[model samples]
Target: MAASGAVEPGAAAATAAPSPAPAQAPAPEHLFRPISAEDEEQQPTEIESLCMNCYRNGTTRLLLTKVPFFREIIVSSFSCEHCGWNNTEIHSAGRIQDQGVRYALTVRTQEDMNREVVKTDSATTSIPELDFEIPAFTQKGALTTVEGLISRAISGLEQDQPTRRANEEAVAERIDEFIVRLKELKRVASPFTLIIDDPSGNSFVENPHAPQKDHALVITHYNRTVQQEEMLGLQAEAPEEKPEEEDLRNEVLQFNTNCPECNAPAQTNMKLVQIPHFKEVIIMATNCDCCGHRTNEVKSGGAVEPLGTRITFHITHPSDLTRDVLKVTKNPFTLGDSSNPGQMEKLREFSQKLDQILEGNVKAHFIMNDPAGNSYLQNVYAPEDDPEMKVEHYKRTFDQNEELGLNDMKTEGYETGLAPQR
Candidate 1:
């Protein structure tokens, strides 16, 4: 070795036995904390990786767990036995939400600063009052408290300050002044605003008074811009112009969603479907690998029509009751009379007829009403129409919309500042 600590040209000729491996150091058990009865199912998966601190092989354990009142997340804990340094981070394990979410919190008290926050890697955190921001992708996502987040920012701001003070005195002094403002935010001096904008809609801030409106916190949702879409890697490529009929068959689009029953991450396959003599609609189907659950929904252009929800509800009911609602497809004959006794007898008659269709050699018509006009029952025999099978779209009545809880959202007196909850 030279005086300046440069290695000699023949240093490769030197040989020595490597040091023995250190005893494995375990990570804190808090990363796998039990938040629910199913927590035992979430075992941590370990992977060997190079530790950032020691540049040596270390273990990284990842556990997928569900957070109460929130969603699923994967907690990662890394430990290096050689350096005795460990770090933990959390990543969202749930599906991306439909719309972007923005949270603006007014931190007024110490309790406010203690509020929990789930900031995803794609989320942007900013203190508007100080004009400071931690841009998206600049820091790893975390499950932490507001005070803990501020302390982390302070540590980052003060990192390598001694060198800066020695070499860049003026820049160091300005940074010192900024650090004081960050400390004041933690002290809740005159209150400050903390904002988190997540285009992926995965970030969240706790509401101490959950189920009740929190005046100190404001949450809003909006669609993401084109630039935001590109940043998120969700931007779809421009399609080549072609005939309208060829648009759907050209590609099968897949989107990420969640299983309705288990809420596990799932993928939804979608393709445009055309019903003869009707408008085109998109059909999406989800099959969960975690749980043996499957769901399919149809959309004409906007929202998912209510027919799917009705089908889901009917499947939950017993046979007799399900037959009553499902009679739209099985039996079209009306049950006579509005009186309770007569209706009961009519329902009894309908049930018996349905059993007859199932057991006897009776041919019954199968008529389906899809609100999005996505159903197709092609007529065979050249151009001949099939009278037994019909596919149709019907206008949902106002009462049906009310049954869907959509009509109940209307506020007639919102200008008066008070609208009663329905």
Candidate 2:
């Protein structure tokens, strides 16, 4: 054995194994790249990886970007040189929404087909005209156009066709006829309805008319079913101990309730949440496992406000397409008999004015009349000042108070005040 403090120089080299090369620290990875408040342009990073198709060297490019007026997403594309196969997928970097969203768009124009669509892996796509549906979890998430979605589905159906033709002639013939019909939709021969239902609420369909109602597009947000919660892995494990009182606002409180649809008993999950600069509101969501019915409703949690609130906002360009605002649709004006030339001229003038607003050539005012004062138009510069928004509080009228059932409400001396009415 070598001496404790002294070793033969040649012996040490021969006895000891070669030191392993210093391992390099891996490049720090993040699901999404940090971006600043201003608009940003993100570039893709390319890496060499093994191809899943041919087991050969392939190139994978990753792009972490934020969609305009939307959330951040990671887009990955892989291409194999040997097999000439390629694939792409999009994953949202944002948190799961509290509710699900369904988008139905009537595709009537080429521009409609060119609209950008974000479909999550857990989203289902359907065409009502064709009675065709691509179920959730069957395809990866995508960031593509309406036409691209249909084209991809067509390609997927055709992939196994050659084998089917050799083995099952009858099946091939039926599919061929279906393929021709799908091709007709691609050509925009007639109007079709495209529906995307996403339980995660992470999917999106671009709205050409923002800050205004789109007649051809109808979007509804609803509570997810119990099964959807499990499928999305959002079923929170019950706490071992009871939730503390201090955290009641943050805790999800479940209460026994009856389903409004089938009258079956179920549970309604509720939480006290405060919207920014808005009053605390209770968001109650109910799901009935018996009838598979789901419902979401928001209730103002405090006493009626003393005064009503009205917000008048100047609508500039409709870029905030993702904002969820209630747009009440009503007829602009009643049309008179077409035989009257005077009424026809008035209608034509009104139509041109509407066209100007929709074309972004003229600005419009969007007003919100909230009697409860809790409802509000979202302020981008909350806690600060926004030049475009004007908020005013006014005393409710007698009719308004009657409608709210506040005619007999008394802030002071309610006990004596009610005796007179009795």
Candidate 3:
């Protein structure tokens, strides 16, 4: 065989030096160069994309968690490391499988897990921004349906038919002027929500439509007091009086009585006595004989009751006299069929004074206790200390008196008052 182009193995291998391989002619400058404006413009802009399964192909994927309700569509360009290829994927709402089910399950599970994890982590996520606007509803002219009309009426916006017609021409002129003004300003206005509170503390909220120019009038209606306005004319005016009018008026009053205990030319002194026991005041007069003796005993000539050792006055407004008498009988201090005579008298006197001041529109009553002791005038009610009368003991006495009618009790009362006709 002729010399074959093959080297003999292990036959003194030729020690020939090997030539160096050529250096990669420094990669063309353009190959490693920064992008040019022209090239960039021609090149498709790179976008990050993600694969749902891997979730790692892109630099970063937008988490569309904030707007989950809206379809989450992420447009990204990803270079697949495993396949050595580049492509774009749009993970849209439709691409998401079992979205509803996954959302429900994952949201609940993730929320619970996140709550636990967040407790340990100090990082706080920012809240999503909400961009929303409320719609404006404004209408001019009469509303169409009955519901619309009713709503307008309740809000005090709709005027009566006659009033509306009467003011139509004027209102039209005003509306034209308003429209012109509004056009000049280039603004849209809505109905005012009028909030009003009444004297009774009830509040109302209403939306009333009127020209913005007429809003002042609408607000005035809310500020007006209907009930108080009606009474403005009827309110009483203060009366001017002379300085000594009260004293002169009191000095002219007279009473007829004699101290039966001393029988020594008695003079009666009237006073307005306030009773703390009953929370009332009475016009009571006592007769003093100037011999260290006094008595409220008296003879009745007019509507007044007979002389009692102790007298009391009941005062009340004239308008309340009848009602008070009926109420007093049912009061806690009533003695048998009658109320406390002293308290009743005081109520009567108070009522009388109120009647005089109110021109018979008020009334009062009067009562009296022992005039000798200051207890009656001092607001101290002690039935045990009085020999002639014992309110505390009268409960037992009146129980027996109930057996005797008024006529029978009067006969017994005449016997107790006489001094043997000496």
Candidate 4:
């Protein structure tokens, strides 16, 4: 072959592929460089990029891996095939020198937008100490003024008779109206307090235009305590007790009387009798001693008498509805013409209306005005058909007796002319 024509050097060798050279070792500079202070300082000390929702930066692109009841974080810096996003892994090797320094990315079960976990710096690091104390509210004494007096009076009046004879609905409406008016008055007299005396049951508004008087005097006069003393004298006077004979005369009958009919022995016998033009009936019980027969009949004579036919009229000043009925025998009054039948009819109508209103079946309000510009509103209710009134009367009588220092027999009985026969 060498003699064949001065063989072209390396021509056949070039036509054949050269054998692969032994793998060359990588240069030392190509490997990772050791961490240095300058590298640590130059490294991103602050987060440069963050997951928009969670606000954490650990990777260039986060791969969302869903797990059962939880989310998974894949830390490899690989492009996500599903999302087509490139990722870069964060290395703390240059920045953190201590082995204790750790970097972790947590994937919470809850979505970043839905939940937030706040990590607060310690109080010693950030929060300042504070001293807290409750503030005190001081109350001043009530104002002394005519307006104050008026407000107090109105409040006391309403408080003393909170319930009206009107039906519940009507009463509620009236209460609302009254409250509105009270609020207006309160606004007009700011910073003043109104005190009500429900127990005294006497209330009146002082007229600012009128001459100012001492509050104590006004209260005493309004309550009629002073007037009462002057007219009725001091309440210390001893009350007179009924004599013993009156008690014997008024004693209730216990035994059954002899029967006028068939004298047979009877245990239960009672009859009711009606009276003409009266609201009350009478009952009587009788019995026969000889034949053991008993009978009872209501007697017309035993019926309750009608209330006094004579109606008196008097101009009343503003006063509390709960006050005791004043004895106005000496007070000035204008007599209505008793002879005028028409006037009497009107009076009857008025009384009927009042009665209906009091019975809670009708709604009405009474506003009485005196010539002196004083006014009063009275809310009355029909008397309950209860025996408790009688009991109360007896108790009052007993109290009066004790106050008078009367003996039991004298206090319990007095001659009242055969018990007035009813």
Q: State the C-alpha lDDT per candidate.
A: 0.64, 0.71, 0.28, 0.28
User: Which stretches in model 2 have alpha-carbon errors above 4 Å?
Assistant: 1-41, 237-299, 302-366, 369-422
Q: What lDDT does candidate 1 reach at residue 34?
A: 33
At residue 280, give the lDDT of candidate 3. 24
Which prediction has the highest TM-score against the true structure? Answer: 2
lDDT of 4 at 355: 50
For every candidate structure, what is the RMSD over all alpha carbons to the true structure, in angstroms?
17.5, 20.3, 44.1, 46.7
**Candidate 4 off by > 4 Å:** 1-185, 188-235, 239-242, 245-422
lDDT of 1 by residue, 157-275 (tens): 77657888999999789888888888888888798898999999989898765434799998888888889988987865687565465756567788786675455677999888665
Looking at model 2, the pairs that clash are: none
The better candidate by lDDT, 3 or 4, is 3
Among these predictions, the greatest lDDT belongs to 2
Query: 1 or 4, which is superior by lDDT?
Result: 1
Cα error, candidate 4, residue 183 (Å): 11
Tens digit per residue, CA lDDT, model 4, 164-183: 53446575565556545554
What's the TM-score of each model vs. the native?
A: 0.53, 0.55, 0.14, 0.14
Clashing pairs in 1: none
- Per lDDT, what order, best first? 2, 1, 3, 4
Tens-place lDDT per residue, model 3, 233-316, is 223335655436355334534545444332334566644333444222234456553545543432221221232234444433
Model 2: number of clashes? 0
TM-score of 4: 0.14
Q: At residue 287, give the lDDT of candidate 4.
A: 53
Q: Give the Å shift of residue 304 in candidate 1.
A: 19
